[model samples]
Target: MDSSRGTRIRRRVTLFLLLLVASSLVGTSRAREAQPLPTAAAGGGSRRAPERHGLSLDFYAKTCPAVDQIVASVTAARYKDFPAAGPAVLRLFHHDCFVEGCDASILIAPTAAGAAASAAPTVERDMEENKNLPQEAFDTVELAKAAVESKCPGVVSCADVLALAARDYVQQAGGPYYPVKKGRKDSKVSLAGKVRGSLPRSNSTVDELLRVFAGKGLGTADLVALSGAHTVGFAHCVHVLGRIYDFRGTRRPDPLMDARLVKALRMSCPSSGGSARVVVPFDVSTPFQFDHAYYANLQARLGLLGSDQALSQDPRTRAMAQELAGNKTRFFQAFVASMDRMGSIRIKKGRKGEIRKVCSQHLLAV
Candidate 1:
């Protein structure tokens, strides 16, 4: 063909490809905006079934059985022997992953900030396994997997196990009906620094949280709902004392807050900067339930994180939080909806991703 003829053909092909890409992008955007919930199995129709035909049940069964065993063992131990720690552990996983699909990424250490980065690496003992909380949830999950390996023989992924545990944890605590998709391979690469960067910190601003979620393609409603996890956990002196004592004048507690309560909180959580005595659980009175107590706490200006407080200030979220706090069914409904949004955040998938074999470490060689 002549040069002009060849160039014309190439231009046509490029135009066709651009149109195709544009069409696909438009379809995806509409699907995401609709964000419809999946109906129950009994509501069968033209809609697709929850389980995909090519997906393997053997893989799910192999992956999930261990989660059942772990839940059973922990419940028995908590109720029969160490009852105090049961509720705390149950609430930790619920609080940590409720917003972002239960990644179990919260357990990782904080990436050292800047120049002090080269100092000796040490885990902050109080933050992870503080007396207010328990380390058994993490340890027991692994142990349960070990037991499953003895029986089923190395078929489950820790990622699936954690996801299962997170669902069960919420359900056991009187939360929403969890809908899960199993088969997440455990990540073998445990980059603590990356995990730290991914999670919201005690002082994170609403803008910071918004930017983080936006990067994952999530919106404001999803961000607020996830902050609802504040209903089930506590904050160490390290996490909340800054707002009480070292507060930068402007971010001080709202005037609407009860003076006595604020004074007591300040006294209890002194400005010692991460002191043991000053630590206060986020949901002080009810640290184990998955209800609207967190929202109620925010109304009283008792929010632990800066991001948590931002919800009450936003017009869109304040009403939702208040309404949910008063209505159990509404709370559950919103929880599920928000959780679905959170889970839809961008994740590594397809041929570009690896099926990790370990939950806390890097993927094993395929």
Candidate 2:
């Protein structure tokens, strides 16, 4: 072979080898990026590791880089047009976390098969505790999920999106901005029977609230800070009527309730239940702002629900509420910390749980 022919052959071979190596590297990176999160055992799905860990903020730094910003923008816009959406979304996140440890179980609607099992209950949303929850809260989650799906396809879980959405809603409502840990997996099952004792009741006592929240890694301060979210949401009249008009068969307003607030409550919620569905803000003073006003209301005996009043009735919880009411800055800091802890509850990280394609349904059978 001529020298020129040999040189050309050598160059061609070297170029081909380099291209092959580059292509291989690219393929390996794509595989890493596209790795599937764990789900209910399937034919070849990722397996759940024996140990479960909490999520991290940068869990999707490479795979879904804009997930946090996407959720923020979507929720902020919705909240701007509809101010009431902020508190509603926050409540939804709390409800979801209280049951099944922030696994997106609350977002699930009944499937055709589950609904057909009329003889036995199926979905969790049908439970009494969840039935009266504002549908707008669930709708806000839907918006956040839709936004995340559009940006990252199926990489982010609906559960994580909900956590982020709750943070965003709080911030938009003039509250503190909190960092949400990511990497939650959607639950494959949501049963009505499981919802009964998992959630906090409107009439729950301070002890009951503390016990339930403590079981999920929250302390007294966390409970107080979280309850401050009531600064923006409204309570159904029926939920507060007993505290205002009749207390434990007293047939009169609770002695702890303020007389003026009781009068206002009666005007909106008649004893005849004529307007049982009417709603009233938890924070009578600053209903639109997310601040320490809730604690202030508790101090003034203007709290709307029996549970809210219970906080001030107990010495330990009352001390926490008083401190939060005295310092808005401290309240914001504690609230942000508590919410972070709440979001970390029993998360399915690494290779457990699925990144649900649709937030409302399980990817695999339970």
Candidate 3:
């Protein structure tokens, strides 16, 4: 072929690709406009406003004006040394909020009094569901709490500190900078038994995930947007072993998974006797970035978890996934809205909760 001919062909191919991307973006914009925003409901009725819970963007303005700055400073310092702290802290906030509402119950250590009150003396963090939560997340919270305590003493609650730290890490990791409403108080109760049905599993179907989120006053959009957190972080082999191996007794890997991904995962997680501690990034393409790549991975059948891939496979959620994959701005906005809602779940205030000087121990126990 002549050199000029090859150059023309290359330029034409580039133009075609750009057009394709632009078309997809236009389609996503139309789909987003067609849908109405989802609102939370309880027993088929509207949810009470988050403001009714006494949370506010400046809840700490008078009591501890420097709370946000202190938390942000600690999160940035920790993240500089350990970038994994960003995802770890994000996961920590989700886990803490899901169980017993965003009250920091997950941070509580087992106490003799707590043990005597229950059949077994286990705290939320020791439960099987929460066992894999990274130490970096816990350390981030502890450090932030210590910093806040130095400046404000007991003025800031551990729950509020955890919320602020989660937002800070998300911003530092290249995600949206959303305001976190404060005023949550640490829960005195942190039972291991409460962990069983509150969280979603790695292999959950879309319908199952919807039901779980619905039970918590969240909608389908919230579920999908929150799942974008998988754009970062990782999962232990134990979570993906079934999908990559037998796949619900089919004696084959999950068909939803990409062929290349299946081959790659098998290398790290063999069918027989693989190390339980082995982990894999949730998003193979840019695993450390907090972005829309997660939805794109789903569209490509490259989602690492069965639950994540289901968003693209299920008819109810596929369009939303495509829209998010095409529009990063939309995904970021939805994520911020959902995080605000999730942060408001069953918050504790007044005499129902207390401000703890130490995050890991209840004041009574301390």
Best by TM-score: 3
- The TM-score values for the models, in the order shown, are 0.65, 0.82, 0.86
In candidate 2, the residue pairs with backbone N, CA or C atoms under 3 Å apart (3 or more residues apart, or in different chains) clash, namely: 38-353
lDDT of 3 by residue, 261-361 (tens): 77767766777787776667787766667888888888777788999999898877787788888788888988998999999988999898999999999
Deviation from truth (RMSD, Å), model 3: 9.5
Q: How accurate is candidate 2 locally (lDDT)?
A: 0.73
Report the C-alpha lDDT of model 2 over 185-295, residue by residue, as the tens digit.
887667777777777788898778766776676666677778888978777777877887779988988888777667666766788737545567777666667878777
Count of clashing pairs, candidate 1: 8
**Ten contiguous residues minimizing lDDT sum, candidate 2:** 25-34
Comparing candidate 1 with candidate 2, which one achieves the higher lDDT?
A: 2
Top candidate when judged by lDDT against the true structure = 3
Q: Kindly report which residue pairs in candidate 1 clash with one another.
A: 188-361, 188-362, 188-363, 189-361, 189-362, 189-363, 234-281, 234-282
Q: Name the candidate, 2 or 3, with the larger lDDT value.
A: 3
For lDDT, candidate 1 versus 3, the one ahead is 3
lDDT of 1: 0.49
Q: What TM-score, to 2 decimals, does candidate 2 have?
A: 0.82
**What are the runs in model 3 whose C-alpha is more than 4 Å off?**
1-52, 111-120
